[model samples]
Target: MLHATGSLLTIDVGDRSVTTTDIDDELAAFIGGRGVATKLAHDRIPFDADPLGADNRLYFASGPLQQSNMSFTGRMSLTGLSPLTDGLLSSNAGGYLSRNFVATGHSVVEIVGESDELLAIHVTDEGVEFEPVPELEDAGVPAVTDAMNDRHGLESEHLVTIGPAGERVVRFASVMTYDERAFGRGGLGAVMGAKSVKCISFDGDSAPALELPNEDLHMEVHREAATSDDIMRRQGTTNLTEFLNDEFSLPTRYYSELEFEGAADIGGNAVEEKKYEKAACSVCAFACKLPTRDEETGLETEGPEFETVFSFGSNCGVDDVVDVMKSNELCDRYGMDTISCGVTVAAYLAANDEFGNAELVHDLVEQIAFREGDGDLLAEGVARIHDELGVENWAIKGLEHAAHDGRVVQGQGLSYAVANRGGDHMYSTTMIPEYHGKIDPEGTAGKAEHVIRNENLNALRDSGIICQFGVGRAVEDDRFERLFDADFQDLLSVGSRVVELERHFNNQRGFDGEDDWVPYDLPDLESSLQEYYDERGWNDDGTVPADRVDAIAGSD
Candidate 1:
């Protein structure tokens, strides 16, 4: 029903051969991005397969909205079986990579097998080319992207690279774009490293013609976003630090406290002082990505986003904005998830409360990236660290928590507990309503219904692969019909079905009620969990009924 000219590109690294197949049925059933990619993971990866082994496949997928003129449609979804969680993982990043990917005339790119040597894959209009990149060994993400662009001529090409963390197979490695955007969770970069892939560069001039249902409405949304007084427009996501800190929802000292003492030093105002420039993804009207530079050190990098500020700053007991920027740059360059890296460091620093030691945080991030000294243990992520050190580490299903403190935000807590990807904030962000004052942040009553509805809505957004912030505001304004030509209710139904599919996949792989526990001991947690399960028609034991699953699947 959408476009069918694009094929699913499959590459076997072992033989260095490429194949293409039409995925019309898959496109119709699962849509694209997370849905289609998760379906591919379910079909191709064995439950018992080692995540880093040849049996596992990595899928980079773009949705139908990709390459459209619509705002916030530039995001891409990367799905794989996570080595950390040992479950289905999908991470999204905003950049030109998805646009370039769509331009290559492919809906999905699947890489299988493993390369015997360090290599890079270049995809162009003609075909795929695998080139050995031995020189890129032990390089950081920024360096690798620079090298790839230099080699290929950077005009229209975009690079997705892994750094030292991935090269060493750190369990929380991240896959990064050229400008430091990352598919930054669940150890996906390790999957690329396990396959011996240094980078994947995309270059093409073929863009599928996009015909929006209402071009005028699309323009209207863009006009509104461009001139809107949204905090995102003024200060980017970094604004969340101050707001969350004000609400006492910021995780500080490894969740030992709900608020940070030095919140003012690393918040929106502080970040604005060091802002070097503002950046945005392809066709995005809300240019929320800010690249900052420290005047003293002259170290410039893409972000120290709200998560970075909370994780590296407050969570690690550091308050210096420059220090957070340095840590963010190091994580970006080294190819590691900032949330996991920062939280892991916080666990090691739990004994000390002095906080805000820039030098100490920098050295610690370096050690983790290179696996030097205690970095080896931290590199294993929060779950394994908790097991080995007997520390009270905060994580759900092996993935580390985001910036939100579950002890305070009951709705976020419930969503975090049941999220398929484990401790993911974006999976079903109840924060939107909380932030907008539509819902009481401290209340637990009726939160389960709110979370369930938001979860279903978010599933549709992610499957459409739209930027969460942009589409989130659109959904709030009831503009889905204007932008996507789909009824909001229909989209929510699709989202509910996607949520069921994800839960089913996790269940088949042995996750149950026990795995749905939040890391924190909140008073209202038990009641909230019960409410969530009851609202979603799931059994009290956290199992979805087979008949319900069948009905949802049948509707699809």
Candidate 2:
């Protein structure tokens, strides 16, 4: 088994108290990261608890592989009840935070109860310290991160901070680390804001010894990733733009169309022209993160990733590459999810016929961060915009849809409809097969099975908290089995159980077959959902049988 400190750090902001607990058998059975975090949320958070209330708990969890020699294991999972979705929410990000957080001898950090005053929580090997950071009030993410690092010294600390958008409790606010990386969905940042937390900094130096079955195999994986022909390494995630546009799956003009006339202007090749440096998470060999700088505007930022490009560039009709990059930088600095920010802005632009107005987009981003004027409504996310204005807003389970235009790709549409985390594409990348032509995009035949299998595999990958880019190669090379020293079938079984647990969480909150729907009309949706339920052994009503839940939990 992997070695860890196996400790849980609990911070009660309301009482200004801290406590620690040993990881117990029940939590251990679920492994770590997303798995253990979900169990904690299920046990501690009431199904009906206000997502932004003191009663709602926020968890930052590191996976078992974190802090190990494994490549792409530097990612972390953040979980809580989402103000946006009103159900379970788990967002993952990659950076130095996970490695240092795990090194602090705590696998999980759970925060509860709101503070009366704004505070910053600092974690070290000595213990947790809560300090008031009133000066950070209404600060942007980059400024907050910089101020904290300057105060604590950058070499020794990693910081996660919320920007003014989060300070205002905007529903889709993001928590950012390393200036650019984010726990970028589901309004978890609003949860932190509700607790009056400005930032979290970790400066622990303790490193747990990892027991690897084959160190040589671990090295081999890293070596392969460094020399691999993976597209991620070559052009980052923006490489998807050309392919998505070619397949007519790119979201353009707020999902009004699938293809953009200016798609090539903001695609991978365009991003390369502005690329200044390539960055990576701790020990990750892919180095997929491209930090770019605009020569004309002197704007510097890390990404306008595939999703960001779709959200701001095509979706909002702002096709200028530099403008999209600037918008992405604004979202990062302001601590707002680019997907939500871009989509919300797209909704406004579409209603107003202000497409391609870069100046208006910039002004709106600032307004939303500060909750100024109409930006207040926009900051609430696309669902609220749809409710208030009766615009053509598309979302699944309250959260805004990702970059992919589901209308063009039926399997992707189905994935969005049934995804536990609303319209998130990362839940299960069903579009992979369709993109490669292994499956027909329009055909619904066997799509449910494809999604189910992908979800289970994705659950496994998320539990390890591995970067999705490394997943295919990892599985093909049997890296997971060798790293965990467990059978592949057993690992897959655990992953299936995790997926069921997530479904069970949603089911308890009264989600049913009706709730699983694409915002746009799909003729074959009913049949597809029925097939999905049948394939997963769920009831036709989309509820897992009680026995099935028990069986999955019992398997743990």
Candidate 3:
């Protein structure tokens, strides 16, 4: 795979067609890889089309720094309307897929339509194919991964597939990539299910020649990763649990309480003690994926990352780390979102007073995994659960049933409500600024700016298809701009413009100030909207300033 030819390819699963587009040096220089992909996705899909219909498109795009020697840069973004939140959703994952996708001379793979039958798209240097995968019809994530690895030879192919959760259209189902990595938010897996796409198996032998702006800049970011305060390389991401639990007491159980007694038991240290081997993403220097077996269940699991740890451990009142790992493994195998599954399960317990009925809850878990009985109700998310159970105060009360409790992380609460995807954390992560004291998560005043900025920047990052951890690991502020060939500020300004464009796109879909506030359940929750707005020069409403929107969306 030579840089002289366009390595990026797009495949239309609906029509079984392949197309390759040249990467304009200008767009290539500014947006880089993932950013460009976001622009393309926004431009391609019709605004009013059903997200799950054949008209919707899923763009799995890689970034310019993907195959390069940047630390934790091997990531790709899955962009589309999330079936979970019903809003713009994009989540990144680390694995060999991004590297393979790019190495094969393809930057993007576009999937379209609700396929009439069960199928998997195999992308290779020889082109692409929509092949049958009836053998894995009801298999779970782990089984599906093993079957694909066995059939394709694990070392040669990279795969992304949906487990039974996706097959059953769980609203929060995630799209699992590689073996352990996942685009694990906003029900993108359900979108894949709606399209009848069982899996994506990618193979390529063409090696990419990824050179940075200057080898010096690449070396600098690489060196920083090795010695800097970045947590992934220094302590692995599992350490985030310690930070979140110790700093904010953020592990809410079924939206009722903020603290968990077992936080330390599920921390990074616990993972090291229990897991077997550690692995890294493609081209990544840090080996953070802790592949381990639970001492009690003897179940081999990949991670109990901060999100998973909180989502299943503290959030579900399941204190035992081994139980959390087993539960995590179960969710992944079943192709369900750990956060939503755990939260939904917790909500169910709270709703039915079954929080005390371990046997009933266990049966429900199995049912949800298989989409049977009450499992069907659980599959729709907390909102639906609240409706079905008819318990207003006991369930996840937001639109998509993402994280619990709108009262605690007010910024997150606003994001859950306004996000087109039901309830989600990633669509716009305001936690970073709030946690840093740059904005107030407890006040709703400046939230509009906080939410919009994070959403835009994260969208660009997600679109790059690189791991979100990479943004913290390699690229941050002006330092990250060095990864691109363009000037640092210029590259970021381009990202700002892309952000505004996304806002405009959302506006077309009827997103407004009303969609920018916290859910009704959180009577005390507020955000830094006022302060954030003052800083960004916006009105109290959080709408993009007319001048700002004009500057970004100029008369084109």
Q: Model 1 misses residue 395 by how many Å?
A: 0.6
Per-residue lDDT over 273-321 for candidate 1, one digit per residue giving the tens place of the 0 to 100 score: 8887777888878788888888788999877888999999998888889
lDDT of 3 by residue, 203-303 (tens): 77775455556557666766765565545543365676766766666545565666777778877787767767657777666566777687666688787
Q: What's the residue-level lDDT of 501 in candidate 1?
A: 69
Candidate that scores best on TM-score: 2
RMSD of 1: 2.2
- Candidate order by lDDT, decreasing, is 2, 1, 3
Compared with the true structure, all predictions reach lDDT values of 0.81, 0.82, 0.65
Q: Pick the candidate with the highest lDDT.
A: 2
Predicted candidate 2 versus true structure: per-residue lDDT over 331-450, tens digit per residue: 998889999888989999888888899899999999998999989888888887786756875768888999866677778889988888889988888887777788888856579988
Candidate with more favorable, higher TM-score: 1 or 3 = 1
